[model samples]
Structures are given as structure tokens and as C-alpha cells.
Target: MRKQKCGVIIIAAGYSSRMDGFKPLLKFGRQTAVERVVALYQQAGVDQIILVLGHREDQIRPYFDNQPLDVVVNENFAEGMYTSIITGVAHLNDEIEAFFIHPVDIPLVKRETVKELIAAPQQLSKGIIYPSFLGERGHPPLINIKYRSAILDNKQGGGLKRLLALYEADAADLPLIDEAILMDMDTRADYQALLIYDALEAPNLCECYAIWEKHKLPENIRRHCQKVKQTATDLVAQLIDKGETLNRPVLQAAALLHDLVKTEKNHAVKGGEILRDLGYPKVGAIIAVHMDILVDADTAITESEILYLADKLVKNDQLIDLAIRKEMVLNTYHDNPEALKKITRRYHNAEIILQKIQRIIG
Candidate 1:
């Protein structure tokens, strides 16, 4: 099938009055928010991007000197965000089949979420496609070029919202599970919270599933991961019930991704490396020891221990006795004495950890 050429329209023309600072220049994590948003679309294979600058064109234009995006100044930017949208749309490449319109403040939308918006036009072929997380609609709505003329002509008053209302019946809402879609930094508090939020938020589950599919994870492995996540969550509930504090998001994500690179040797190590590369160090730490965590029974059970113990208790998706799981591992490597020896050590470590868990929660 021929791929549609999609363009990104990033509206950076607002004054950012609520934020009390220039949002485009603000640091989201390592890079400015504008750079992050552009990188997201670029990583998603967007054909091109048209960045609309208004309030601080000179200040913003220099930032993208070497970047791969079209920077167009909006003289009417002070009017509102709608003018920026119109300004960006006016610069869309003639060949672009669809374009995504979002703001610079929303920099954390996942690559998969953008791809989903881009794909909506091919299937629906008309109207607007908006990404919804939980129940809230998200930015960077992908609009078909078919509505280009209509959008440009609707200068009546309501901006993008009014433009979309004209074709309300034709709008397509693609449900997504990405919390990043529902969040945007609008105030100083929001920005401050975003820094901490970005540091702790796990990679979207949709993106996790995409990675699993991308690696062609076998159905059994996928099921095993799901079961492990369920087991881990149950343990977490128990810990919380006993007034134990834990980072549930990190634990859940680690469980879901403990075997990310399962086909590779030392998959736990490889998975940890992958998560860290993807900017999830905390989750990566837990996944790193899922196969053989060093648990100090003297200390309380930690997230890493929970993941490790849960993994040992699940074999091919079904909750199995730890002894049976260890036997299966040993039998599989019976011919290799050295491998059997390693398995014995792993089993012994798991037994010790299990005793600690029972002592704490039971």
C-alpha cells in the first residue's frame, strides 16, 4: 500500500501568559519543549513539519537554525492560537495528504500515538482525527487535506474549534491509552509538575505493545509478561494494604517489559539497557534484576524483589509453584552442568526472597 505523506503543524505562536515564560524555550527534559515535539513527529516518520512562530519569532527561529522544520512567522499570532493554526496550515506542503495540528506545550505525545493519528486518514479518508486518552481529547489532531479549503475559509470567528464544528459528523476519535496525550504544561505549577511527572511516567502501554509487536515477541512470551504484570500488581496491592509505600507505575511497567528483548541472551540485562535508552531508568533498574535479584531479607521487600519473585512464579502465563518453575529451568539445561549450576543458584536466591516476602506480608 502507498503511504500517505503527513505533515506536522506545531503552533508555537502563543504568548504563554499562563506559564509566565516562553514555553518554546523551556526545558522539558534534556531539550527544549519545541525540539521534543518536533523530534516526536520526525521519529514517527512524518514527511515534513511547519512550525508557526508568532510572539517570539526571532527568539524561536534561531533555535531551529539547523533543525529540519519549516519556520513561518505569524503576524497575527497575538490574536490567538487559531491564527497560528491557520498560519501553519497555510504553509503545509502541497503534497501533504494530511497534517497534524498540535501545540508546543504538549511535547510528550508518544511516537505511536502520532502514527495512529496519521493512519486515521487512510482508513476514514475524510474529516478530522483526534486522539483520546481515557475520556479526554488530545492535541495534534490529524486533519485530511480534503478539509484544508474549509479550514482556511472558515474565518467567521471560532478558530479551530469552530472549523471542526462545521464537520462534527465527520470527525473521528481514535481512542489511545497514552496519558501523555491528555497532559500539557500550561502554568508554572504545571511545568514544575511535568518535570517530575516526565521523570516518573512510564512509557505508554500502547508503545510497549508496539515494541513487543515490533520485536515479534511470541504469543507465549507476551502472555507470560501479562501474567507477570498481574501477579506483580496483586503483590503491590497487598503491600499497599499493609501500608507499605511503593511506586506502582514503575513496578507495573517493569513487569510489563521485563522480557522486552527476550530473544536475546541475558534478556533481563538487554531489557534494562533498552528501557534506559528510552529514558526509563527507574523501571529499567527493576527489570534488570527480574531474573536474579539480590534481595536483602533484612530489608523490606522492594519493587525489584516483587518483580523477580513474580517472574519466578509464572511459567508460560500460568501461575505455577516456584519449585515446579525451578525444576523446569533445571531440566531444560540438564545436559549443561554449568548452566544447571547457575539455575540452582537462581532457585536458591528466589527461595530466600520468597521467605522474606512471606515473613513481611503473611
Candidate 2:
């Protein structure tokens, strides 16, 4: 089968009334909001991109002068976003099979999300595909070109969302691990939060919880992970006071998701694979070694070491002494000599990390 020709329509014709600054020109990292959204689709190998501009058409138009995309001015953009949507759709090429309607304010939507939506199995069958995170639908719905006329003829009061709602039977929701799908820069405070979120390479607190809910982690395991997160963050705080630089978000997320696949064999490695697949290699690396991390004379107090030690210190949902935790493990595996040796090695590794942390914090 041949690949579908996908395109994206980015609506950047808004007044930025709620936001003190122009949403498209705002900086997310080094790139402007409009630049990032355009880059996202470009990187996803979009066939044709139609950028509909209106509010500050001339000012924003120059930014894409050399870029390979069609930029159309939405003359009636001040009327509403629906006008911009139809303006963008009208410019889509005849050969484009499906297209995504994206708002410029939602610049942080992951590249993987676009690829996932485009490559969805129901792309041909479904008229609309909504990217959902934690059961909430979000920006940039992928619409089949067949609905080009419907979007152009949309006279509904609730905008694009309500117009799409009319075709519920023809739509399907594609659940994604990305929390950025639900994030938008509506206000200054929202933009500030997104800036902080963009700084971290790992998943944020909300995404971590969403992962747990998606995997259906049991209540007991959830409580244990919560305790581990508290213990790990507390350690991070003390260590930072001692002038130790650490990635707190990475550590916290790794600690919470360390036992993600506890029921599976080699759960540490399995959990790591799961997280890495979800676009979090940093957190996955820490969880991968949470069960049996290598500790040596040169081993410093790293995030992996901190997570490993934190896991050992917590039994179930309670923080217990390492010595007591080690005893309980040995007692459970006393009958198997090989298992006992492995357990001893793991406890010894934890001790090395604990001593390293204690030496600095004390």
C-alpha cells in the first residue's frame, strides 16, 4: 500500500488578547512559537503545509519567506478562528489525503504525536482523528480531506470542536502519551508554565501520572511509588543544599515509574523499555538500573544511584532502614543460594550509594 499524503494547516491569525504578547512571536526555547509549530510538521515529513495568517499577517509572513510552505492571508480572521480554519483548508492541495488543523499557541505538541496521528490505522476509515491524553481531547485534529467541504461550510456556533462533534460516529480518538497535546499558551501564566516544562527533557508530573493510569498500575503499587517519589525528592533537596547539581524532574519521574512493570520478569529493564518508547530516555535509564545498579569506588551520587537507594529504603509504602529491608529480602530468598548471593550484591550496591550520599549530606 502507498503512504498517505498528509498536510497541516497552522492557524496563526489570532489577536493575542488574552496573552499580553503575540502568541506566534513568543519564544519557546530559541525558536518562536510559529517557527516551532512549523518545524514540528516539517520534521514529521508533512507533504503540504498551509499557514493561515491574519492578525499580524505582514509581520509574521516574513518569518516564513524562505521556508517551503504556502502562506495565505485570512482577510476575515478577526471574525473568529473558524474563518482562519476555512481559509487554511481552502489552500490545501488537491492531492493531500488528510490534514491537521493546528493553533499556533500550541507549539509544543511533540513531533511523534503528528506522526502517530498520520500513521493511525483508522486514518482512512475515520473522518477525524483526535489526539487524546488522559481522556481529554486536544488541539490539532487530523481530518480527512473529504471533510474539506464540511469545514469550509461549518456554520456551527461552537467553532471547530462543535463542528467536529457532529460527526462523532465518523471520528476516533488516538490516545497519546504526550501531555503537551492538552497544553496551550492562552495566558501569560500558561506560557510561563510551558517554558518551565520545555526546559525538562523528561515527562512532567502530570504525564507521569497519566502513564501510570494508562498502564493501570494497581493502587498498592501507586502508593509505593508515591512514597518513593517523596523519598527521592527529599534526598534531592538535601543533596542540592550541599552544592550537588542534579536533575530533579528526571529523578522524580524515574522514581515514580521505576516499578511500572513490576509484575513482569526483569521488571526494571522492561519498565525502562516502556518509558524509553514513550520518549523519555533519561528517566528510563534511571529506572532500568533501579533494581541492580553498579556501584564502585568511583561511583558518585547520581540520579540513578539516588533512585536505586531510594527504592531499597522503601518497603511497600513505608520508608524503612536499609538494614531491615536487606534482612527481609535475604529471609525471603534464604532457600535459594544463588538468589541470596544476587540479593546480597544488590544490597551491597545500595550501601555504597547510601554511604556516598551520607558522606556529602552529613
lDDT of each: 0.83, 0.90
Q: For every model shown, what is its TM-score relative to the native structure?
A: 0.69, 0.94
Where is the poorest 10-residue window by lDDT in model 2? Answer: 118-127
Q: For residues 280-311, write the lDDT of model 2, one tens digit per residue.
A: 89999999999887887475579999999999
Candidate 2 positional error at 16, Å = 1.3
Per-residue CA lDDT of candidate 1, range 63-122, in tens?
A: 789888898989998888877887888888889988888899987787867877777767
Q: What is the lDDT of residue 147 in candidate 2?
A: 88
Report how far off residue 72 is in candidate 1 (Å).
0.8
Query: How many pairs in model 2 have backbone atoms within 3 A of each other, for residues 3 or more apart or on separate chains, i.e. clashes?
Result: 0
Clashing pairs in 1: none
lDDT of candidate 2 at residue 103, scale 0 to 100: 97
RMSD of 1: 6.4
